[model samples]
Target: MILKYSNFEKSAFLTEKKFFLFYGPNFGKIESCITILKSKLNSLDRTLKFLNLFQDDFLRHSFTEIVNQNDQDDIFGNKTSLIFSLSDLRVSSEIIKLITSQDLNIQNIIFKTGPIQKGLKIRKFFEDSPDCLIVPCYEDSLLEKKEVIMRVFENENIEISLDHKNLLASLLSSERLNLLNELNKLIIYIKTTKKNISNALSILIDNNSHDLNNLVYLLASKKRNDFWNEFLKLQQTFSDEIKFINIFSKHLEKILFVKDKILLGLTPLNAMKSLRPPIFFKEEETFLSQIDLWNFQNLRKAIKELHLCQMSILNNEKSSKSRFLTLITKILDL
Candidate 1:
């Protein structure tokens, strides 16, 4: 019922149980797996029929009625097999008891929705059930790295990598399913476009992403106006909660206040001293030196961009879109 294993382990684990509960924080990968399963259902058995548990008049019908439908008899009886796909698990206790207590002998797959913590709780529930085969779906963290995502971008033949940071950021940006869908769309777009491919693909695959606005503000703060402009050009559909403003405001304050008192002129060392360095930066000093070469004049442009970012936060705070921004503004000077 409750077991942890990689995607490769699924085939071997199939013999272990009949009720497969695929629960995880990462729905993107799980969704892909489901899609694959749906496609392969017929291949597994000619008489196999798939049913959407959340579809039709499911709300009106009790779980017992749902499990014992006439259509189900066609699949559940004799050589026929039933594939039950559930996106939600809010079924009544009566329905759950019916399914668990009876020897239904159906292949049930539950798609765990929501955040990782919630999915984990759902997984534990199924783990206690003796008659079900539960597979908690989670991405392999080691395989999902910046390097792997980049490889996918470079070669369409390669599968997209599930980098934890990028996946988490995408999840925070939107729902897990939506983010996964977007990433898939993005990959398709890149493949179709004739534009010169560069390391810009790297930006699309971040390990950690702040709120879109915070990301916009940070790029603007850095005077990477082109990147900021491109980001803002994205449709309103991408607007995530303004949680990053607090973090953005804090970082902006540092950008404005932190100065290299040790060095009078702009230098590689000075730039490193002034700005908060990201974790990846520590691995490469060349990036720091390039930043330092920009001189005070370019840096001032970056600061001006931050001023605009600050204004955006203030506007959001005033509109009550976010109170965090107001608190951030009060703590830091505009």
Candidate 2:
């Protein structure tokens, strides 16, 4: 059986089947679902034992050993809730065989994997199995995100205006963990201060705009020392490296557009004027100066470097802060 993320509930895990598969790009949601399942299982069977094992551990240990581990009887009985975070799904055949055998009496077996392709044998095995369920976790839509934010705020007895809620939703990342982290920060802020839209915006948005704008200005104008200073300050204020990369990419793209116009025989001043969204009057002079300082080649190189930095951040989150700082230093040199 297959389940959509929204439709998943703890009751689903109570079926006669012991095996469950949760797979998708949204690891946060998958983990939350697993928590709910575990909580529900524990409530129903207090004596049930919980075991967590990685795929490598499972593969390294003999099948008999795994079965024996699961089959171990406590003072009460031999019931174990097993969770396997699969590092690789290519061994799905062996996993499926082990889970299907009636000889081993495991209470519940949960398998989790990162995004699986549609044609993968492992995905098909779980989806097609009558005795197991596959739950797909996808990114939440904007409306869903808004609902989550509203629910969180409401639970805390904090009332947010629709516009403020929308703004918060726009600022939040689609990933649940990041979103929750931001929400927790905002909730704490609200609890400590005046809980109005103005206060919320002041707490969340006001501090970020100046630093971000200054960082963009410094990078575009090729002020190495100032850019590094602004970058450090912005990093302190905003911990989301991906969001910074996104803002940097947009600014670089704008510069690229202006550079293209300048290449087509337009003066930097005229090119800034020609910008579609129209540069702010106050920033137009600085924008034009940036256009004159950066050429198409440099702008393109910066964009590519920023993109690679973004990919690195996503792939290896642990070193993202250092990676981003290094990227800025490299771009400054470029």
| Number of the top TM-score candidate | 2
lDDT of 2 by residue, 134-238 (tens): 898865556778988999988988878888888877666567776787788888877787566567777567566666777777877779988777665544234
Candidate 2: residue 90 Cα off by (Å):
5.0
Please provide TM-scores, in order, for all candidate models, with all chains considered together: 0.51, 0.67
Candidate 1 residue spans exceeding 4 A from truth: 5-10, 36-44, 70-88, 103-112, 115-122, 138-142, 145-193, 199-334
- How many clashing pairs in candidate 2? 0
TM-score of 2: 0.67
Q: Model 1: how far is 179 from its true place, Å?
A: 6.0
Q: The CA-based lDDT of model 2 is what?
A: 0.76
Each model's lDDT = 0.47, 0.76
Give per-residue CA lDDT, model 1, range 245-320, as digits (tens).
Answer: 4344444444433334325566545544556544244423533433333344544544454455556654543333
State how far residue 265 of model 2 sits from its true place (Å): 8.3
**Candidate whose lDDT is highest:** 2
Residue 282 in candidate 2, Cα distance off native in Å: 10
